[model samples]
Target: MNESIHVVCTHCHAMNRVPELRVGDAPSCGRCQQPLFQGQPVALDSAHFDKHLKGDLPLVVDFWAPWCGPCKSMAPQFAAAAQQLEPQIRLAKVDTEAEQALGARFGIRSIPTMVLFRGGQELARKSGALATRDIVAWARSVIK
Candidate 1:
């Protein structure tokens, strides 16, 4: 029997069951018919955050604001990290400015904070901008 994993759709927030072997085959959401992993960080708001957090794959979320210099500088690196980390991990972004409640809920006191979650629980958190390599390494280390 093939093992399956639950991946939340980034576009529609629908839950999807993907065979483990086909995770890298570019799976699509059953409800919305959108690609499951788009190779980039998905922009999330409070409405869709909880489902993504509860997915079987680990979730890496960057809490950032538009005016923060470090956050601006880290956007490209975060995007690049998404390319390297998807299928195994889901990378997402929450604009703190637009989602103040989420930021507050996560106890984010600083911009450019990256939080890793698994099974709807926070596994680890880091505060600062990280290079693409560092982002991948940090997430991998935490998940391991």
Candidate 2:
């Protein structure tokens, strides 16, 4: 059997065993059959945040609230970026209203903030909504 990484499906919260080497490839949830990177961000509760921070791979989290205009506006672009960047990065979302603790710990004072983390450390963060290209560019720059 090949060693694999356990990726938590953001859609159904199922654990997916993905080939370790294919972390950058387009992957789908085994049970849900949904694209792991459907391009839209995955909602991350506090538990999910904690679990993924401990992961060895890089993580991209979008902290947004549903009611925020900018957040809603950027949704499609964010999703597109997630879809294109799957496998190489894990995309997640933290609903500021739902995950209050996470928002505070991360010092999020605004909506539509994005943070890139690796090995439990924050590599970079940006506030305000951004386009899909900008999102991918930022992640790529910081992850390198």
Pick by lDDT: which candidate is best?
1
- Candidate 2 residues 22-129, lDDT tens each? 766778889989866555567778766777676555899999998899999988888889877876787888899988899999999998999999888999999998
Q: Which stretches of candidate 1 lie over 4 Å from their true place?
A: none
The numbered model that scores best in TM-score is: 1
| Range of the 10 consecutive residues with the lowest summed lDDT in candidate 2 | 35-44
- Residue-level lDDT tens digits of model 1 in 1-144: 999999999888999999999999999999999999999999999989998887899999999999999999999999999999998999999999999999999999998999999999999999999999999999999999
- Scored against the true structure, residue 123 in model 2 reaches a CA lDDT of 91
TM per model? 0.97, 0.80
Going through the candidates in the order shown, the clash numbers are 0, 6
The collision pairs in model 1 are none
RMSD of each: 0.8, 2.9
- The segments of candidate 2 whose C-alpha lies over 4 angstroms from its true place after superposition are 1-6, 11-17, 24-40
